[model samples]
Target: MKVTSAIIAAMCLVSLNLGYGAFYVLWSIADQAAVARSEAGGGFDPSQLLPYGNVMWVLAQLLLLAILVLDVVAIVLAIATWAGRRNVGRAAPSMPTAAPGR
Candidate 1:
């Protein structure tokens, strides 16, 4: 249980970091677009952004996918932990035993 809890915590942290990374990547793409627009005299051209935006967009997508996978893993771990505890409870009983020569 402790191990599972630790793993879940770690996964949550990693997911958070990935989310931040995604946000940063998206922000970078926007910044680049804005720069391109300014360079083009306020007319935004999709072609002007080109490869940089494309690469950042791909990276953001990959980060989002990783975050999603981590979320699923954490959820599965939580459910498994809950189910394990439930099974342990069901496997143990506090019934009184018959005394010898009673």
Candidate 2:
């Protein structure tokens, strides 16, 4: 069924989003801690010399949160779509819509 394939695809997308979000959050916290430890242990402030790491860390944190939110949104969308929810996508409604230009 077309709807079934779309649902499966959506599920796969959600899995990847959540998995990557978890990895991102864990990595950001761990990396931040590691950087702090290394710095406190006498590692020079290379960030002052090369700002990429600092920028990357910040970006990673924001990205992690964004991904988490996006995953939640995707789950909500998937569930609503599967249940024949109305207005989920008026433009191109799911199976219940029949078709466009009708």
The local distance difference test score of each candidate is 0.75, 0.71
Clashing pairs in 2: none
Prediction 1 TM-score vs. true? 0.56
Tens digits of per-residue lDDT, candidate 1, 1-102, equal 887878779877776976677687778877777666758766656565545766876777797787778778877987997798789857566799999999
Which regions of candidate 2 are displaced past 4 Å? Answer: 1-4, 11-15, 18-51, 85-102
Best by lDDT: 1
Candidate 2 per-residue lDDT, tens place, 1-102, comes to: 977887787788778777777876786676677667658755666553334667876887787688778778877877777676576556664475556788
Cα displacement (Å) at residue 93, model 2 = 23
- Which whole-number lDDT from 0 to 100 does residue 78 have in model 2? 70
Q: Estimate each model's TM-score.
A: 0.56, 0.45
